[model samples]
Target: METIGWGILATGKIAHTFARDLALVPGARLAAVGSRRAESAQAFAQEYGAAAAHGSYEELVSDPAVDVVYIATPHALHLDNARLAFEAGKHVLCEKPLTLDVAAAEEMVRLAHRHDRFLMEAMWTACHPVIRALQKRIRSGEFGTPRHLHAELGFRVDAPPEGRMFNPELGASALLDMGIYPLIVAHLLLGPAERLTATGDLSERGIDLDIAITGRYPGGALATMTASMTSYSSRACEIATDRGRIRFDDFHHPDRAVFTPYRPGRGSWAVEPGEPVVVDGGEPVLGRGYGNEIAEVGRCLREGLRESPLVPHEQTLALLRQMDDLRAQVGVSFPV
Candidate 1:
């Protein structure tokens, strides 16, 4: 095919979103889908109008028509799935958190580089234009050299003991799942953190119910983020800068956010709509998942870029390293 063709390796909810979004981009094709079960793969393909489906991951990766693969398998399989795609000479966009831990993420990045393939941790929030706008405004001194951030991503999960989040074999934890979002967003706005203080409550099976973390980055910038699988949060992330604070209504994966200028010694702030960057307001793309990341993978394939600047290998690794440390502090090690 002349256009970039995508192969989705997994039939999870996020995978469906990715596929649905992939269709939105011009010249992008939902070429195929792969699932552990043939029925699941076929069902996903039919739902997304994809051309083909494969029962096994290897089959999907090696499909000649597929220019790239989006791996939305669980965290534990991220490394393996991405490596298989790279070996098959296809670009890969793996869902976050990129792997179970930093070591796995590092190995995956190395594998991609060694094999000369594009690889990216599909942190969809990073590619979001609204997020980009926020980052730019913050960096441009519009937010006055952002000094602090308050963020959280959490929702109660009352799954059975054998559920994915509670399954030790799945490398499950709130820090690695819900936690990565706030950490990554902190990195985006405040850059790498220099100090981290974290605490959490773990389940009997070792899953985290919640984690509250504080990071102090270079230049005294600080970010406090909390994530949990046992509670709800109204605000996800916020930034307080030297000048003013930026507010994200739904901070982690935001659709619409606003910037308020902080005037020194002034009781109130100014919320200047930063051009109101808005995409088509409609039902979300659901067949595969967030289409922007899938489209980005396709764009990289077409242009031959080895990775997404938005979700770089180092960033994923660093964030995971921090998360690993936090989990360690809380004594929440996965069985693996």
Candidate 2:
């Protein structure tokens, strides 16, 4: 297709953010929007300039104008939503974590292959310019051998018990919503986890509210990560290498990654740091970085690719598997 058409499958906050960034991407347009409520669909369509408002998901997926569907529904509904889109012959960009567990994610992938359509988990952090650049540099040994990484993302969630953040039925957990970032960053920078240990506090509803993860990655690199729903965090990330230290004040939507080299000392490595190098994301970070993912989706569709190289299916599944283990260790389980 010359121009990519997008169908947003929900009218939630994330959907709105995606819609806003969709406008910034070239060769992409919001063709339609769907919601359980007609009015919600209509409002989202109007706000985003979608050509059609679908009261039901079936209508949105079936709309000829919609070449691909962006599933922004809750974690629990992703399987069904993606199934609807794939069955209707539309490619999918489903939000992360792909599903509550690996089996469900595998099933989603299976459905996509069965339907012969494109499928990708919306792990936009993997597509962020800064993260991508950092990954390349780390792999290239630009900053020497990575030794340790620390990333934390959290916030004081004040939503009601029935809301998506606290609702077990919606597959709500701090691990899914917040911890995924730290895990993904560690995977991207330090390579896959060879060993992992987790500890956390769960809500009365059996959902994780606070979680801490420590892992040993490739090259013997170690990482410590945490996610919380009852406090505030800097949302920062730091990676220490033999040659230097890389830091991002806000790794989630970082503008740049700063690397500071260690200075030589009389008898030991300098306790003080040397000159710093600021690594730009290499591409313009569009609208909180969601635009980058949209652009990625468009590029993949235009190239007739089945999945994004940045957010590959295997990577998504691997992270979900890690989460399953972590949740099990922490005594957190969601109803099936």
Candidate 3:
């Protein structure tokens, strides 16, 4: 199909953002929305120009009108939503850290391959134009990436006892939410960490309040990163290479990256300012939270692709494995 019909499976803030953006994005249309409550679903559809609404995820998955399903539900529900969508013969593009663990993620991948359907982890930063440029720079030897990298993504989520941020059963934590950014940045620079040293503090409900991780690559490339929900820090992502370094403004969300190259003659560094370098960072990317991600799903569908090369299965697996290890090191465990 020239344009994709999106079935959004949540009515959360991100869902609302995505629905709004989908309205404006090329190659995308709001086919339907799903939520546990029929009223909520109907209200969302009416507010967002969706042609249909389903009170339950099952109905949304089975909606014959949709070409793709954008699983914007919580991480714990991603696997199920993907499976349902795959069964319904729809492509799947779910949010970051797609599943609670690698095992679940593997199942979703296996099913997608088995069903001959497309499935992609919604790591939007990986597909963002600015992050793509950074990757190209490193691949081109522009940065001579032979050294270390550091990325930090955190926000103050001072939730009360058993709130999502502190609730293990809900899979709430900074690492799964904000920490994925640093992990993705590191993964782009250095494939998988050969050696990982990690630790973190747990909330009262045993969810990770915060975590600090250090990963060593095969060639001695290393990454030091942190994620926290209890406190706030610089939402910066930096990749250091043998010749220079690249840093991003705020979160990697919108990809305003700056490059610094070592200057032998100057004995310091030459810099490429972040986005809008020519004029305050170019045309800023205004967005509905899920807009770009929905477009990515459409692109994959039109290409007859099963997985996004930008947010490949292996990378998602590796990042989740890293998180699992980090959580293990910190002794965070959820009750079954």
Candidate 4:
């Protein structure tokens, strides 16, 4: 197909952002939008220039023009939303933390296979140019051995109790919202987590509000990560290696990563940072990188691929399993 048709499900904040970025991606167009409310769907469609709008998800998926469905619903609703799309013979690009837990995520993946439809977790960070470039360099041993990593993402969420950020039914957990970024970054730059220990503060309803995690990764690499909804964090990340250190601010949409080499200091065993080397994601970052993922989905559909190499099904499932264990450790659990 020369162009790919996208049907966006849900008209929430993230959906708006994705819709705006979708325009930046070539060979991609907003074919339609779906929301439980007709007004919301129509407004989203008009704002994003979608060709059509539907009051229900079923209608959106049934739109013959939509080749792929972009599920922007809450974490708790992803499985059902994806099931709707898959059963309707449409591919899916669901938002991250794919689901509330591993079991749900697994079922979603199975559904994709059963329907012979493409599915990808919208883990845009993996598709980011700078992060991808950094991963490539670290994998090549360009920065020597990455011995330790630190990442934190946080912002005081002032949403009401019934809002998505604070509502337990909506899968509101700081780890799922903010912490997953750190976890994914560590997994990318360091490796799969070998052992993890977690501690956190939770709300009366049992949702995590603040969390800190320490883990051991491949080749003995160590990582410290934090996610919080009740405080302000710098959202910075760093990887320390024998030869140098890589640092970036606002890892969520970082423009570049800087690597500073180590050199001998005053003492025989001491070392200090030298001049820094800046790394950029080779291609232009289209609208904070969401466009890259949109482009990836279009590329995959055109190439007849079921999963993305950058954000593979295995990786999505692996991280969900880790989060499940972490939530258990932190005494956070949602109602069934």
Candidate 5:
């Protein structure tokens, strides 16, 4: 396979991580780095060993050497950055939350389809080996008929009001930034929610500080998820089924999970538990598993795939719509 040239559209922390991970991917090269400031872009390029550095996103997207552009900009800029890349005939692997809202995400998807360019929301968790193993177990019906799920992700960030976590202008909200993790795991395990209810607390800046969501799936499975930036949480997920329960600690980037089977004649609330089987994610590729998604993008590009089957366009839209609905319920709206 020919090497794929990657242009990073931002010099943010996420961009640094992606560039670091790109080094681990076979046939993937960090061909360019772009930022609003020339100094920032040049520094990132020097650090990442990119062949080119552009002072502006337009310059980066227009680089003929860049086969794909990774949009690691803030959520607010995703739509424009992605559009610019697609217009330049570059495939896109955008940071999750895709855009500030469902409408923006839809527009990006439409443009990608119309342009015949590959586009995928960089939900790296969807490409992890651990997640694949869990999917396999679910498909094999090892845990019969999932009934309930509980997941949470939270951390305390004592940033000032102007910080990204509390700034509505920057598309800051616990639900969109941190809460998406729990939502992603729920979607992966239980599929889209048929109905959902949400409650949240907001900052003085009108940003969501915390959010709690409960969803009911068409299959009768129930999910409870919570995300917060003002508190600390275990960041875990548990899926209960007729046969047993699967527990994943730090579910966002899980390294292992445990399945505890239920014995016959034991009620769902019974204390008698069977032996627990530990499933490890095994050794990840370099860059702590981010390479998985990078590899997936490379494979899709090589195969002429416009979107990954694992993280399809429909899934991204569905998730975005869910977030939109949740935000509406909580009365949270971004400037975008």
Candidate 6:
């Protein structure tokens, strides 16, 4: 197909953002939107200028006009939603944390490979230009060997018990909702961890309210990450090397990063620290940066690629395993 047609599976906030950004892509068109309620579907389709409004996911996937489907449902529904799209012979772009557990994630990947369909986890941060540039620099060995990485993301959420944030039935937990960002940063910069230990505070509902994770990489690198829903944090990420350190203030949707050089020891003859060099990620395009990942999906479709190299299936599975391990350590469980 010359122009890829996109269908959104849900009418939630994240779905709306993806719909807006899909419009900004050059070779993508939002052809349809699906929701449980017909009225909700119609309203979303009208607002996004989509041609079709599907009252159910079945109708959306059966619509021949839609070449690909973007699953924007909650964490618990991702696996089944993706299965529906894959069974209907459409490519899928599922939201982050792919699934609640490694087994589910593996099943999704296996299904994709079995059907020869395109599938990717929508880890939008990995698609950002700033992250790409940082990876390039790290590979180039410009900052020496990375020794330690630290990242934190937290915000106060005062939602009701039934809300997605605090609802155990909806797969609510700080580690899955917010901690994934910091973990993604660590994995991107330091690869997979050889050892991991975690501790967290749990809510009355048996959900994690705050979590702290420490990992040791195979190359002797260390990473510390934290996420919380009970307090506020800087939401920053720092990667320290022998030569210098890179800092991203808003690591999830980073638009700027600062690199600072540091020297060890208090010797008078040691060279003084140099001024930090700033790198800007240009400007935000189409709804807080979802456009980049949308464009990536279009590119992969056009090239007949089934999986994105940036957010590969293996990486997605590995991250899911890490999260599963963390939850096991913290004694947090969600209704499967």
- Give the candidate number with the greatest lDDT: 4
Off by over 4 Å in 5: 264-275, 281-286
lDDT of 5 by residue, 172-273 (tens): 999998889888888887878899899999888788999999999858999999999999999889999888899998787788888888766776435444
Whichever of 2 and 3 has more TM-score, that candidate is: 2
Give the alpha-carbon lDDT of every model: 0.79, 0.92, 0.78, 0.93, 0.89, 0.89
Model 6 has a clash total of 0
Clashes of 4: 0
TM-score of each: 0.91, 0.97, 0.91, 0.97, 0.94, 0.94
* lDDT (tens digit, per residue) of candidate 1 on 210-237: 8999899878998888998899877557
Task: Report, for all candidates in order, the number of backbone clashes.
Answer: 15, 0, 3, 0, 0, 0
- Worst ten-residue run, lDDT, model 5? 266-275
After superposing candidate 1 on the true structure, give the runs of residues whose Cα lies further than 4 Å from its correct spot: 263-267, 270-289
Candidate 4 clash pair list: none
Q: What's the lDDT for residue 258 in model 4?
A: 89
Taking the tens digit of each residue's C-alpha lDDT, what string does model 2 give over 1-336? 888999999999999999999999989999999999999999888888999999999999999999999999999999999999999999999998888899999999999999989999998899999899988988999889999999999999999999999999999999999999999999998888998899999899999999999999987899999999999999999998898799999998899999888776644434444447788977899898899998999899889899889998999999999999999999988887
Residue 222 error, candidate 2, Å: 0.3
lDDT of 5: 0.89
Relative to the true structure, candidate 1 reaches a TM of 0.91
Q: List where candidate 3 sits over 4 angstroms from the true fold.
A: 264-290
